[model samples]
Target: MPKKFEEFKLNRQILNAVEEAGFTEATPIQEKAIGPVLSGQDLFGIAQTGTGKTAAYVLPMLMKLKYAQGENPRALILVPTRELALQIEEQVRLFSTYTDLRTVVIFGGIGPKTQKEQIAKGLDILVATPGRFLDLYLTGDINTRSLQFLVLDEADKMMDMGFIGSIHRILEVVPRKRQNLLFSATMSDLVHKIAGDFLKNPLTIEVAAQATPAQTVTQKMYAVPNFKTKINLLAHLLKDDEFKRLIIFCKTKTVADNINNFIARRFGEDAVRVIHANKGQNTRINSINSFKEGNVRILVATDVASRGIDVSEVSHVINFDVPIVTEDYVHRIGRTGRAFNEGIAITFYNEAERYYIDKIEKLIRQKIDEEEIPQSIFIEETPFDERQAIAREIDAQKRKENPDFKGAFHEKKKQYTSPTKKNNKKSYPSKNKKRR
Candidate 1:
């Protein structure tokens, strides 16, 4: 039987807020993690996305903080990206509705003047990206003397983004006696190294295996021949009403833009939006809001949005390009099958992407079911340039595996004609006649 929130003995005010939030029972991660958090122990958690991990730590921390009487923040949550910072802040606000717990979220891509002002006004919980947090801390706007709880959300992504130095710096500034919580979807070597340094005899929690996708998501893939054909397959899939709300993840900003244009042209302007690192902060926020409100049917984005988005009821997540970083495969598909909702994940891969597909399967410990392309959709022939590109990519992969391996694009040695009597005699006679 699942555990109920009431059994956790939370305060009446927080119970009321939980009831209003419509959360009756605790998720597995929440059930196991909340107790340790409330007991004030350093913890290291390994769970995939959409597992209610945020609330696992947030609720207990809120209960501990109680009435929120502090001039500076008592609890700090650090995330990798601006989107995730906003998402965590939203969660903190929702659960702390019945209390006076003030919250502020700070991130980069915008000026820090307003964020500093908010900090000056006093807050109980501070959610911020590492870079912006360091910036504010350096400016003397943030006080760490009163911090009691520290949480690192998506620690693996933070490591991937090369925020280790910033994290180390933040660790140096914060008080050493505080409780620490580190949550990550995958446990890489780097995460392990940080965990060794960050935690103090912490309790370890593993709700699921590392890099595993949620069971609620059905996985499927198609062997697409070329870029145009992949687009055609996408169009065919979208024609069905079942693909109600979907996110298409691309490998690069250029591909994301191309997909956005194609989808917009086919489904009209309001049906789609694209987001990437180059897009402005307001544009990214507004696009996410539009998608969440159902104003947009499709969102095209790169991996920057992979672990950041928290939308539930997403019908499908399409991988327009296979991620070279295998762990990201888990985060990309995790966007759907959220909140225990049944969802589907579809991937389109060309010949060169098979290498990444294999790595993903190994990481997830499951083989994605492959399906043939529908005959109704026209299969475009691979363009010469695209074919060469694929070949070059394959060669690079091979060279990465073996340094001495020569690529297929290398110059070919001239073939020496064997001494055939007829060919050799004819060559001599032709040479004599030419001389004459």
Candidate 2:
């Protein structure tokens, strides 16, 4: 049975646009969210990315504003990153094509004056990153006092990026009486706090369990001995003709660059590309575009690509490094297996990485099917070694992140434990400098 937009009470114009855009079926998230949103109810929607979330919010917002249009806007959507904000703006324009609505997007990395001018011209829907939105709001250029709808898209990523402070500030400026919709692939404590604060008797529309991996994706693991063998394994997999449009995820910017260099050194410079936190916005966008156009066969990226990457035809996802969080694994694998396409996700594992595997299983709620090691691939190489050196390097990286941390003693590393100091009488002699 073909599902029509009218069945969900979507108006004629939106139904026409959906058909024109070639969307014949409502995705699970949309099917659940659109009805509640159209009736002017607060919603907390949880669904994996590329499942038509942008349209889910945009369609309802557009319908609500169809009978009414005004400058200075009644709706506001906040996203965590500039890429997501712009993507939302693009979708808004597409979905609101038949209407005379004015949707403006504000984000960093560009001059604020232009954004101010666009907002000054009047906006019916404003999609913005939290920082820039606060910037213009503080400047008295943005008037969100009349805002009627607030959508916090990708609430998990927003909290991860430290936007809670800005989100709070923006909420303070906007009218208290409004509809708040929160959408994310995973539900976290941070998300719960926001829901507690912003939503009033909200409808919870969770398409699946939190941190759940998409059913269209099949995940596998390879217990590579160490980093070098991991590289060789990546190379070998890349050389296979079936590995098309691959996104190799690395743990850090340096690792992403290193893996990109390794792939480029053997294969050509154009064969693989890397994007990470240090990349400029233009470079990141260009790399994403080139990869989308098939100019770059492989894209090695950090967590930046874990969200906001909407490409649909990825054939394989290789985790060059295991994800630090299990929720990230779901987002990483979700980059592929989209739009009903079957895709494969492969991860390199070592002894140290085994701890994350169970967490990943528990999050996805399924045991990952293991494949027998292809001995021919390992036969030519020296025997594999567990990643003790890699562990040391990761430990050093952790120390760099938290220098003041005095690590807890582990049974295996007890030999390396430092001796504790005994309290000395001389050290606290009359402990009062003021007495002097």
Candidate 3:
């Protein structure tokens, strides 16, 4: 049995807010992490998304910070993407409803004028992406001298986005006596390196194994032959009512757009929306809102939206493409099975994607249950170009495993080239040779 939130000895106001937010029992992460955070100790948390990790840190931080204070923020939370920053800010507001703690979130993709103005006003908590935070700090709009708490949410993602330099810069400017908190779903080498530099004798808490998917989420995989066949399978599956409020994750912007168009044509346009890096900030937010509000049944998106979305009761999460980043498979599936709700996670993999599937299984420490293609759906033949691409990818994977192992593609290339062809060609004089 899990512990209750009241056991944490939180203030009545915060308890009320937590109750209003529909949380009564503390999750494993919250139960373990809140105490250390309240004790003013550095913490390193290894937990997946939808594990109540946000509230785990936020609640304790709010309890410590109490009410709003000076003009400069006392607590700074850094995230990787704008979506995640906004999501964290929303969580802060939701948990701080009973208190007067002012919070603001800033990111790129728009003008910084509004963000600067918000910073000018008094705020207790500031959530921001690394780039925008650095931009504001460089312009002298941010004051880190008053910071009492610093959090690196989704530390792995930030490191993946190459924010280590900015993080170091921020560390240099901030007061050295503050508490540090780092949270990540998966602990990569980069995350480990950052932890060495960031935390000081921190308490490490792990609710689950690194990169492990929630047990509440039932996992399934389909051995798809080609993209078109995958589309057919998707169409067949979406016809069922059980796929309510699902996210279809693609590998690229082009695939996301294609899936969105196909779904729109099959279903109504209002039933689906798509988001990727190319989409504007407002557009992305609106699309995500529509999905969260149950107005959009399907959200076609790339990996950018994987760790950022925080919707509850999502019935399913479909991996339209196998994530090349194996750890991302955990994050993508994490969109569902939130708040202890039972959900389904389905993945589609082509011949080339099987390699990634193996890696994902190793990372998650379990094999995904494979399902056969439905008889109602037609499996299209692999196109010649696509077949060649898959072959090349397989060759690349082989070379990655064993550099000396050249596959059939290499042999085919060798077969096409003539050894005497080079001798038949006219040779040009070297630049160093003097011409007469």
Candidate 4:
């Protein structure tokens, strides 16, 4: 195994940048993946977040591109989210600082004229989301004939977001002979199918067991009764000084907004910021940057921001609600315990969410330690409507587990309505009977 990054045969400029970045040794993924990528082979890598997978590809890509002399981008990177595109572009810039390589990032939510202007200036590396990339390509602004490398970062995420059609269209446009690299945290069937279409007998690299959480993060769970109790538990947890910098992950924009308001009210406005799809692009970017810079103590976000946003030294990751997407649990907690740092992940699940929690545990291949709810925290009774909703969900889950089993709601409807209808028919007065 290589002791340091220099052993990977990277160019002097990349070496200098890596040293400056303080990466003393190659991470497991980086150590294993850099060689094949540098050898100009198609690669399929399975690794979790914070495994230094970005550098594994970025360094080699930079070395291959060497100096910038192209009228268009020689390499194209497709990410699932705009934040990921921006983050990858930042990484490309960081690694290519000492070199002459130029990088540009294009995504949705901003006017294309600016992106077109940047592309017209010429670049070696172009990082983009599928929608924006295809739009610029179809508009005759981007020239893909010169593309030599194609990378699909977070391939599973792209598939989850229904980008397969865009990916197919992109494949039609880009040169067929270019190298391909795919990186995903989980190797789902969809990912494999896309890989078969994209890669040419690729080298498969699995750094760890698929869908497993990072070992550096300590995982625990709290069984709150309802939304209000969840808030109470969260407030109690935030009181601990250990939770210096934290992220609260919610399932929806509405939940994220509510959590943001609650936290801000309790902890003050200066300490909290919220990011979700509903927020304006600039606002989302600013909130994320603020959290990354430690200007804010807490960030409330939905799953849309879960996969690619990298913040350093995050002390804790709190799941404000159980993610319905089982795989998301891994990515959500991955916000903490980055770069081999010790961090904690606390999840709050009510009775309805336990089904999702079970799926998450099965995906991660481990049970989360259950933490007792403190007596000091207020446990609110589940609201009537919320209780009904929870019961319906539970019944649905039970039916899913056993197809022969009827749901509680179904049984109740059948029992009460059917018997009442039978009784009414049996008791109906006939014309033959005399009036009472």
Relative to the unseen true structure, what is the C-alpha lDDT of residue 401 in candidate 2, on a scale of 0 to 100? 69
RMSD (CA, Å), each prediction: 8.0, 9.9, 8.5, 7.6
Q: Model 1, range 317-401, lDDT digits (tens) per residue?
A: 9999999888989999999999889899999999889999999999999999999888787877665557657877998999989
286 Cα displacement, candidate 2 (Å): 1.7
Clashing pairs in 2: none
**Which run of 10 residues does model 4 get worst, by summed lDDT?**
427-436
Over 1-436, each residue of candidate 3 has an lDDT whose tens digit, in order, gives 8999988969999999999999999999999999989998999999999999999999999999998888999999999999899899999999999999999999999999999999998799999998999899999999988999999999988888889999999899999999999999999999999999999999999999988999899999999877888998999999999888999999999999999999999998999999999999999999999988989999999999999999997999999999998888999999999999999999999878999999999999998999988877876766555665776799899999999987856765564233344432322111121112
C-alpha TM-scores of all predictions:
0.93, 0.85, 0.94, 0.93
Query: Tens-digit lDDT track for model 2 on 1-436?
Result: 5355768776788778777877888788888888889888999888877677888888988888884456687889999877677668877887777778888898888788888898888879999889998888889888876788999998988888888888888878889889889998887888889878888999998887877778889899887655666776777788899998989999899989999888899999989888888898889888888998899999999987777677789999999888977778888898899888889999987655766787788878888877654644542232212223444545655565688644432356564343333222222122212211
Question: Candidate 3: minimum summed lDDT over ten consecutive residues — where?
Answer: 426-435
Taken over the whole model, the C-alpha lDDT of each candidate is: 0.91, 0.79, 0.91, 0.88
Record all residue pairs in model 4 with backbone atoms less than 3 Å apart, i.e. clashing.
none
Pick the winner on lDDT between candidates 2 and 4: 4
Q: How many clashes does the backbone of model 2 have?
A: 0
lDDT agreement of model 2 with the native: 0.79
